[model samples]
Target: MTRILRSQGFVTALGALVLALVAAIGYLVVFDPARKTVAYCAVMPDAVGLYPGNHVTALGIPIGTVNSVRPEGTGVRVDFEVQEDRALRGEVTATTVSDTLVADRDLAVLGEPGAAPWDRSTCITKTFTPKSISQTLQGFSQLAGQLTGGGNPGEQTRIRDSVVAFEAATSGTGPELNKLITDLGDALRAPDAAIGRIGGLLDSYSRLMSSIALNWDDIEIVLMQATEGIAFINELWSRVVQLIDSLLVILPWLNSIAREYGRPILGALDGALPGLRLLSANVAGLQQLVSMVPPIVQFFEEVIDPATGRPQLTYAAPKVALPRAEADRICAALNGLRPGHCDGAENGLSDVNLVSLVLGTVGAR
Candidate 1:
């Protein structure tokens, strides 16, 4: 006993234990181990595999560990012992997640930027529970089993019959089905052009809708006015129906006339086509010429024949009567090879007025 008490090994061991205890006590004093603050969150009943000592993260970073999780009324109240410096804010949300399907869940707290400060005294009202991978796999399994009818004889028979019918219906259409599939793939792959066109169409439709919205009042007024015209339109429709009946009665005769004389009428039009084309070419000049006709008619009215009680179409330097046929040809004779040819003939007049014959030709009487 004396040897052991005096031994350097025992003394060294004792000094090590003393040093470790002092360091631990210093650490506890410095870190304030007794007074941890907690934030509370009410979590869903199916926190699946969450437990005490599970790491709690805020925004994916570890800020604390779940201190306790216990049933509070209907749901579970989870207390998280968080570092006072890393407390969550008003826009924070807590959820339970796990890294692997079989792993214990961790409470994941997320916070929004620029949110109001979270009060430590108040608990987060709700928690989000994400669907677990096992649940997803179970659902997929159920669907697969259903599709295969879960080995039931009647269901299997029905599935077989349906597949047989489908096969029979498509038996002769392999090439068509192959072509359809190829075309469908091509269409789907080339959808960028279609999508661009659809976008343009949507833009045009949007503009059209906007235009209608802007002019809705005017459109309503116009529609109201159109509604007021329905009575007039009804009367007009009756008259049109009568006119159509009359046309129907005359149609046979009209058709016979067309059949017999269509060629001659078309021939006449063909002959006049050159004149019509010429008139069309000189439309502006023809319009100007037509405008000058009124003045010319007025001038003819001023020159009236007192003796004949008509417009004096025939005017000469010395007035005299010639036969209608002679008067007609007098202008031609004056225009001929002999200059004074008319003077030697009937009344020794120097000339017959050429302008008078022109006026007479134009129905100035």
Candidate 2:
């Protein structure tokens, strides 16, 4: 043992062994095959900035690396390995995202854990590559060209001239334009209510239009009738004009005649007005008189002789004489006096007073 320790060759061999063991340990720790990982392949339409050794991330966290990228038909297939703990599964999607405009792209895997884990046999069919900054700028340039009339010089010139003319026309309207913009902003600030009202209005308008469409035939008939009525009116217009002319021609003569006769007619009516009013005042008494006519005719019929058709007259002496005051009251009542006019007597003749008057008159005769 002492001889071996003193041997320089032995010391060199032992140091070499120790170094090899340390290197082996470091290799195992850094790239251990025991750590499980899942291999997956994704076919992307464009893998422009993606290359081998590119990081594969889940939600911006680096989880694996791209193993290879090669063209397959029209698209590029990307082979990657992800840590088994962060294993991607069914319906997984991959996107190449860049940290910045100048930075290399990363493969981002996105999906929730599914029933089946992904293997190399399972190729991710869904993948996206965002538009590059240059491409986006090129597209914007094309849009701007189109807005400015593209390659047509005449159109461009016309648009430019129109813009200039508009600017000239609106030269000093800054305040007005500002006010319009401010008012528009205010009007649109709470747009939900306005949008709801507009929606309701549109719905009502649609219903109205539908109703109008349904009643189109009736509306057409009404329009036709109105057209005919207008034509009829037009046809009568000349007659109306002629009638008006005739009236105009006769108006002076009518005026002259009215001046001559109107006064006398008015005067006569005025002269008779008092008598007419007096007659109207006694209307109730007149009604009472009219009601008495039927009874009078019936009485005359009862007294008439059938053979002669003439009323038969008879006289008899009174059984009892009526007092002068009672006779006066009876006479006043029979003369159609008002109820209160005949004091201590009814407005109508009583049976007793009527009999007494008749008997007394018969006796006097």
Candidate 3:
């Protein structure tokens, strides 16, 4: 009886061991920590504390763990084995976050999310959105450049201009500027000379000023009168502008004066050039006639005795035209009179005839 009991006990112990082994394997299949049940793909610049068999959690609940971490192009690819019921929505951010206490940055997530019913059986890889340190650093650097103005396109040009101008002003280049300082030093040393010169200048200026000040009342009255006259003139000018604009024909008249009359008057002066030449020759001859008078009479009486009728004097032959109305009109026009009006006054033919004036003014070598 004792042997049979021992045998039964041995069989039961063996059966229990088999059952525990089967249970462990079934537990591993259904909730395998490394099998990537309901897996998700996350990208990270570096593999965040995640490696094969690293634990994962959702809302502090142990949901799954990392199954595999592999290099993926520029970044690393990580696979997480999440629980069947755990939810990971689009809004959730996956990043490698760190704490001062932690030796390495941890693979973490935020934004509590929902999962699909079909996601339990196979790997439903929703990409985990991760924070980029490089992008953050780039943004910070760009912002710093903008704030300092040193990175502004033309800021360096402005700084260069200011520095160059400062250097130029401090450098001495001109004699007048050097002498100005020298003169100031001398004047400060010789106070008497400076004071005497200043006094003399001031006295002269004072006398002139006194003369002006003595007539201050009259000056003020004249100034007031001038101001009134100016006001009247401005008012008149304004009215005249209105009237002129109303009479638009005046604009064409002014245009014609500039185009036609202005050039022709200069041409008219050129046309009268021959007459001017003749007048100059006449004046020169008149001067010669006066100088030769005494010599001529003596020659006539001495060389050709009129008492013997032996051709005492040979008359100087000449044909002179009398001044006609047309010639006078031309002369008057040349003399700067109204084109056709000439009273033949002294101004018409004076000590300075038209030819002498024209030749002196316009015909100089």
Candidate 4:
């Protein structure tokens, strides 16, 4: 029993010395400058689940931990650590995570360490609360109420009813969506039939156009012939028109010459009309007078001097002298005979045969 008591004392002393050495090591660790960090204050809307100890990271690297939390106003003030060796101008972030990588459980971590508040970087000591404690507590209270079937029982019943209705309404959406897709497919296919007909019509039109193109040179020759015919007709019309104009210009002069000649011709015919009429009337009178002149000439032939036995009227041989009484009578008869009548008588008084009588008459006269 004494040996057990001595062994117990020795074991107690060794344990105490081991504890003192650990304490000394912890003090030295706390005071060391290389492992030392700074204390900073962060303002957050809520504390989340930060406790006494949490890890702080600089750009996803663990640098330090959260120290404490205190209420400032409507928000919580957080005390965190940052290594002094690194330059830090902005505060760090604190969040409650389902799995914590901190030395103490359920503590906060620094969101980013290189963030600067005063150096124009977008670093803010702000927080976005996903699930607030107060909100969680309020949800718990509402769940408790609903479970007890007390206070706002009508709202709870309506909510349960609405969930059932929603599930029923959304359940047939799959079939409805399928029908919609079928109608859309029909609509999309409806235009293809018309497009096929259009393509056929266009092909026919192209064939017709090709046929016309194949005959283009013949058509051009026909057109050229028609054009030449039209040009020839136009030229002929121009020449005919010019000839008509020339005839028009000469017509007046021709008419004037005809008029000038026509006046003298008409005047001459007017004068000749009366002369011709008088001449026609006188022709019968002149014909009758010409017939009566022969009878008077025959009476003169009967009265030819009787052959005288005495020399008074002897025309033969101038032989006998005339008796006084007979000579006187014959001389008177000779004086009465007309010279133009005796000479113009066709049967008896030819000058060639009456030369002795013509000489005796001339000597007596």
Candidate 5:
């Protein structure tokens, strides 16, 4: 063993073997294939400071490494691998963040773990790439140039003065600004219950809009009918206004008439009240009398001669044989005398002689 150790060739081979072992150890430490990891992807609008092999972090703690960064269409697709044990689980957002202006950006996985594991098929589409300080400053410079470039010098001066004043006003209020920011943050921080209510409200509003869209035709018909009804109401209102105007014009005449004759008219009505009451009480008799008027008018109309415009009288009598004594009695009674008090009783002639006059008249006819 002493001779082998002292040989120059053995010593050279031993040193080479030690170097090979060290290299293997370094390779295993650098790229351990046995370490389990979960693969994920993210698409970002911009990936300026991000590169392959960059650290992927969760809440600023390193948990993974970016596998690749490549352009896919209009976005940058970032493929990453996280330690399987520390895999991002639920709905999460990826944001590119940097520690400083010059520092390299990292892919930040933000959110707490949820019930389901992360879906490998889907990419993290919800990503934000905030503008770097240099980009922001460049944007401001461009804006300033644009404002000052126009020929309106007064406007340019005003804008510049405004910016200066704003800077001056905000320069020394650091504590107040901090307080304002804190308050704003507090105000924006919604509780779980509030968030749930907001979500429910949005869902209800969505359903309401859908319902309106579906019933748009019926709603349109209702609106049209309402419009027609309004027009009719407007016309009726105009008529009412005209009636009111007419009443206004006639009011003075009515008032004058009332002043001139109202007392006499009231007095007459008061005097006739008993008669009016009696008439009302005999309304049935009045109705019967009114009923007889039509037949009387008909009889008069039948008796009138249309050609001569005069009334014509006609009579028909039945002939009857009466005893002479009874006839004489009737004639005497018609003359306002008793039967025995006739002036010509033996000759059957009275002072008036109505029976003989009627017989003579009939005989002559």
Candidate 6:
């Protein structure tokens, strides 16, 4: 028994047993039964960041690993293994996508129902390679530089000035930017936000596309009507252009006329209004006064001499003398005084005592 125990062979067997126990423990702890059912898929070898042991995911869940990448035909063949629990089926597409901005990549499998299943024998006919983060950033930088006219020294100065201006404009926006980021985080963390929004957007886009497809004829009719309206607008614009040109030609003469007569015309216009208002106010009385003028003019025209065609005037004395008492009363009445109070009435106011008296004569010139 002592000899058996001291044998190096026994020690080796015991060491092997210890290793077997540890291996069994590890197997129990880490092994997944799902991974035992392996599947293969091919991808282009030149795809960026693709390597063995990179995860394969479907529906954003990790379900497989890249087994090997090797040359196959002119392109590359990527062998990948998927867990049994996550069925690798349908018209699946394995696309390489970045897990982070630092160039880490993974294979994303797109799966659908009612399609063929994939296994070790199945070949992935299509694969997509995404742009690396560095490349994307470089492209953005180039675009920004181009937009700022970056080329030589002068262009660089302009770019620097533009950057400085931009910085100045955005200097006060730190708080707003923080708030924006916080709001964005909250939005992204909301339940089903990204997926639901994308789904709704896709559904709306699909509806829009379908509507356009179905109503193309109506859309065409609308376009035709718009074209006709545009044509009419074009013609109206042409007429307006011609009218403006004609006005331009006449404008200098109109300006000269205005400069010469502007004050006089304005003064006349200002003065005429008051006279017009006065005429309006006395319109009825003036109409009555005007009615008497025609008759008086006609009478004067009849009294004119037929040969000389001139107006005449005459003065005559009374044919018989009034009684002395009657004459005194008539003189008092004519003098507008009491009957016996006229001093001149007693004198010879009618004292042409001769039986016939000569009177003054007036006639046409």
Each candidate's number of clashing pairs is 0, 0, 0, 2, 0, 1
Tens digits of per-residue lDDT, candidate 1, 190-308, equal: 99978999999999999999999999999999898996699789999999999999999899888999999999999999999999898767778867869878999878777776578
lDDT for 298 in candidate 6 is: 82
Residue-wise C-alpha lDDT for candidate 6, range 1-365, written one tens digit per residue: 99999999999999999999999888877765435756777756355677888888887878888888777887678888777767766777778877576665788888776566765576887777766667789999999888667766666677668889999999999999999999999987886888898999999999999999999999999998998899999999999999999999899888998899989999999999999888667777877769878999988887897789888765443443445667766555634532222234343344332212221212211
Candidate with the greatest lDDT versus the true structure: 5
Clashes by residue pair, model 4: 56-64, 93-111
* lDDT per residue (tens digit) for residues 1-365 in model 4: 67875797888988999999999888888756457666666667776556666666554566667778788877877676667664355554555453533323343444344565323233235554456556779999988787656666556576678789999989969988899999889878898887889999999999999998999999889988998899999999999999999999889877887788878878889999998898667768866757757886765554564475332332443322344545545444544553331222233222222344556666743
Better of 2 and 4 by lDDT: 2
Per-residue lDDT tens digits for candidate 2, residues 1-365, read 99989999999999999999999999999767578888889999899888898899988998999999999988999999988888886668999998787778999999767557665686898889999889999999998887778888766776678889999999999999999999899888978888999999999999999999999999999997998899889889989999999999899888987899989988999999999898667777877868878999988887998899887976653333335557566646544533322234234332333444444445632
Clashing pairs in 2: none
Pitting candidate 4 against candidate 6, the one with the higher lDDT is 6
Instruction: Report the C-alpha lDDT of model 3 over 1-365, residue by residue, as the tens digit.
Output: 67865798878988999999999999998777454356676766667455677666654455666777898787787777566556565455565544443344445654444533333233333334334566678889887665556567766476568789988997766788789999999989999997899999999999999999999999999987998899999999999999989779878888888787978888899999998898677767777758868998887677776578576545542322324535565555555732322334343331224334444457442
Better of 2 and 5 by TM-score: 2
- Give me candidate 3's TM-score against the actual structure: 0.27
What CA RMSD would candidate 6 show?
Answer: 18.7
Order of quality (lDDT):
5, 2, 1, 6, 3, 4
Residue 193, candidate 3: Cα error in Å is: 83
> What TM-score does each of the candidates earn?
0.40, 0.43, 0.27, 0.31, 0.40, 0.35
lDDT of each candidate versus the true structure: 0.77, 0.81, 0.65, 0.64, 0.82, 0.74
How far is 21's C-alpha from truth in model 1 (Å)? 3.1
lDDT of 3: 0.65
Which residue runs does candidate 2 get wrong by more than 4 Å?
A: 1-33, 100-103, 113-120, 157-279, 285-365
User: lDDT of model 2 at residue 161?
Assistant: 84
Candidate 5 on 1-365: residue-level lDDT in tens? 99988999999999999999999999899767678999999999999889998999998888899999999999999999998888777787898889887778899997567657878889999899989778899999888777786557667787778899999988989999899999777767856667889999999999999999999999999998998899999999999999999999899898998999999989999999999888767777867869878999999998999899798987654333334566566555644533332344344433443455455455632
